[model samples]
Target: MKFPAPLVRLWHRLGSPRWFFETTAPWLPWLLGLGVALLGAGAFWGLALAPADYLQGNSFRIIYVHVPSAILAQSCYMLMGSCGVVLLVWRMKLADMVLEAAAPIGASFTALALATGAVWGKPTWGTWWAWDARVTSMLILLFLYLGIMGLRQALQRPEAAGRACAILAIVGLVNIPIIKYSVDWWLTLHQPSTFKLTEKPAMPPSMWIPLLLSVLGFYALFIWSVLQSTRVVVLERERRTQWVQNFVAAEGSKA
Candidate 1:
């Protein structure tokens, strides 16, 4: 069957905030529900059912949280950079909406990565913190997330906030590669990267599969949260506009 080209064009055309909001609202409930369900299931399987590592013992279970959080932290920044690219190219409010929504979340993930890593480190590496290149690069990532958020706050106007934050986000993205390679580049104290999804692992899928599900669950939650935050931001930014006032009044009238 041949798909209609115009339909595809129309679909892409409607990816803006207004179209996205209207179209995606119905799916939000399911997205959030599935995210929660998967998170619980994955957590149980990874933390309780999975066998302890031969060397690390039960201590390795920390990977259930630490690995997912660390992966999300880096992935979130990459996603943020993609949003910045959209903002630069499309000049659309929705793109800015994504970045604005993502700032706090990305920061929280970075914090989680650092905190969970510290917890895992105490047993495995014998220290809570260190100045190794990998550790320092992750620290820099935390600060970069903070920097983007700060830029957003420093500017009151939406346009100013978006542009400033976008710049910071772009600059900060340069650190992602450095973070990924720091262990190899500088012989850092941090453990070498072992979870390359493309590569075969020494461990069997029975263990890593559940962990991967947990990562996907965290990602879904992050996406849902960012969309929610972006919606709120759009409303606040457009509050004084006629559409927003009418929209609010209509909702309030319904209530």
Candidate 2:
């Protein structure tokens, strides 16, 4: 049997957690800096400087924060599931760290998404909560995150926990599309995306500039945070190893 070269290479790399850590750690600080700068700029420009919506007025500004967070929330889970699938198929330890690193961050994003959505809903829809398809689906997504985190912690064996979380993540992926297309698929109260902002963003540079930057900023932040947390997860999982102890001791001596 011939093994695909790329897949074989990926599987080999995935087998080593230390390699993944060393490869990704150097990028985290740079990504963090870029994320903060772009996100701050986008939030300020979109929320304060951009002209109010003609229909909804000033209240619509919340979308600048809400929409981005919500979008990231759904996308992050998909990324997690994709990582899980890769881990299970390739038998990669790094894949498990990726999943653990993402769980809390994804859950936090989901919470932020739901919170911001409710706040936006109150002003636009005249209600804070709704039984609408979109809202329900988002709520379910939040639970799915909680479940994955919970399942991971509940299991004793590292491999068993990782496998269980992977399965749960894959099964819960059914809700991603439901959240994405809820507005289109149902007669829900949630509004669809529009093409305008700031006296109607007349050009792509005007509107999409921030949109793209904000999305990238969010993704960068997600990756940076995941890398930082994955370091912790790796340390915890490998605490008995000599490397982690020596690394911690070296840091302490420096301090």
Best by lDDT: 2
Compared with the true structure, the alpha-carbon lDDT of candidate 2 equals: 0.78
Q: Residue 153 CA error for candidate 1 (Å)?
A: 0.8
| Model 1: per-residue Cα lDDT over 57-162, one tens digit each | 7887777787788788888888888778778876767778888988889889889888887877777667787555546677888888988888888888889889
- Model 2, 107-204: lDDT tens digits are 99989989988887787777787655667677888988999999998998989999888888887786567555764476334443432222444534
Error of 1 at 35 (Å): 0.9
- Residue 171 lDDT in model 1? 70
Cα-based lDDT for every prediction: 0.77, 0.78
Q: Which candidate ranks first by TM-score, i.e. highest?
A: 1
Please list the residue runs of candidate 2 whose C-alpha ends up more than 4 Å from where it truly belongs after superposition.
Answer: 1-11, 178-207
Model 2 earns a TM-score of 0.85
TM-score of each: 0.85, 0.85
